[model samples]
Target: MQGDYQVISTLLPLENPDHLEARGIHVVRTDVTKDVSVKELKDFLQKFTGGRLDILINNAGICYTMPATDTEIPNVEKMFAVNVFGPMRVVRFLHLMLIEAKGVVVNIGSIGGICPFVYGSSYNASKAALHHYGNTLRVEMRPFGVRVVNVISGEVSTNILKSDHGRSLPQGKWSSTADPAPMGHTDTRAESVFYPLNEEFQKHVHRTPNAITPNQYAEGVVKEIVKRAPAAWFWFGASSTSIRMVDVFLPRTTWDWLFGRMFNLRKLADGLPSQIKL
Candidate 1:
């Protein structure tokens, strides 16, 4: 089965909806945060496929990188509305279609939730909330023969950096490693800048040697989604293994210290701006 891209209306520009239709891919804009929008999507789908759907993928998500010190309450609220509640709304609204076909429900999550990162508390927390929702929904939906799959992704080249972020991380500020350097290693690259540590975590992330491209990540994820007996959880792309490895091997306090040093949390927490718009 071909992968379908679900665009969230508020963030995506659907200047020409017909553009995608011409290519045999229908683009139905749905905003999971709004009940009205979700209802409208359900109505449209009922007509389009006669109230039957083989798969429902709740993949709408947003990310913001900022220290919790400067993360505005409104920003965190927005992230939760989309990343967590969004899935709940979509799955609830599409239950009829899903149950009709005994379809699969896919929730895209992040390793940030599984293994919290520095300077991205809001985004990480939002993902964690969604991850939990998937677990609960898996059991609830099982009665209807609907499978719920949680996709915990690693770093990938995606438009989220530009759409969700205000400023791009300077190409190479404090260089990380190409070969899995442990905590406390220091390296530098071109266009590197330090201070005002709000963007420190992001800078550290993008400067990494490599990340799986979105195309490759999508291919693997789609394959998993179509399995006869799909696994309840999945991990894909770069840094996914690293975080899992740390979680398995390190103690709670040790993991915290490692993230603190690797991300310069203390140094940046004291330097937070009054407010930063993510």
Candidate 2:
């Protein structure tokens, strides 16, 4: 059994300690956004496992909710650094180890990557790129017997929503104004309109009414790897199934309209608080 696995993530979740220990899983912390940090982390993994790496889970990503118009240029770079390039870096560096063992690479993406959101351009674009990259890599690595699985998850109860990167309604400089409403728009104020819409979008979009735990997600990954023939793509949690259906069946124009409504874009364009700027 190739029991040696590596989980790369930015923050070491408190739940991870016990979770990993119980499953005999070895944990490694790597700031995926930094090249030097990733290299150091890879060195540590190579040394720790005696250069025998089996399963690599590219699960580290940062989520942010900033409207496309107001999203900082730097934010897009940072997001891609972690979400897209970070996984590619790991795969490229760990290729030698995986090739030796004929191991598996699991890239964790998001539902947003497949389906766009109003204030989630940076996060969405990064994941979308990741999804494509994983697909291409899977085909390229076929001869090496190295399987690549792109895991696209819907809404799960994670720290993403509470993270500092997430755009909050009343935290930054824009929040202090008495009425951040642009002009002449009473029903469609940006601040007042976007906050509630964001909440509602989250409510209906998730597949499961309850949030899926990290442990639950981890278990699914384990199952897929253990199978004789693992699937190329895995969609887990409640929201993921529905989102996948939408991804396959909906036309581009329909998706645009649906996504616009989901993000309250029309309202925002109408001078309502449609977008929650980070």
Q: Which candidate achieves the best lDDT against the true structure?
A: 1
Tens digit per residue, CA lDDT, model 1, 57-81: 7777777765554355666788899
For model 1, give the 10-residue run with minimal summed lDDT: 175-184
C-alpha-based local distance difference test score of model 2: 0.69
List the candidate 2 regions with Cα displacement exceeding 4 Å.
Answer: 1-25, 164-210, 272-278
Clashing pairs in 2: 188-272, 189-272, 189-273, 190-273, 194-273, 207-238, 207-239, 208-238
Residue 29 of model 1, lDDT score: 65
| RMSD (Å) per prediction | 9.9, 6.6
State TM-scores per candidate. 0.77, 0.74
Residues 1-278 of candidate 2: C-alpha lDDT, one tens digit per residue:
12443543334434455655455555565666667777877798678766766778888787666556445566577768778888988787778888887888889888888876656778888888999999999999999989989888866777666554324442222242344333322322224334445555444333233667877877777898667678888888758887788779877577788877655667555444323342
Candidate 1 residue 202 Cα shift, in angstroms, is 7.7
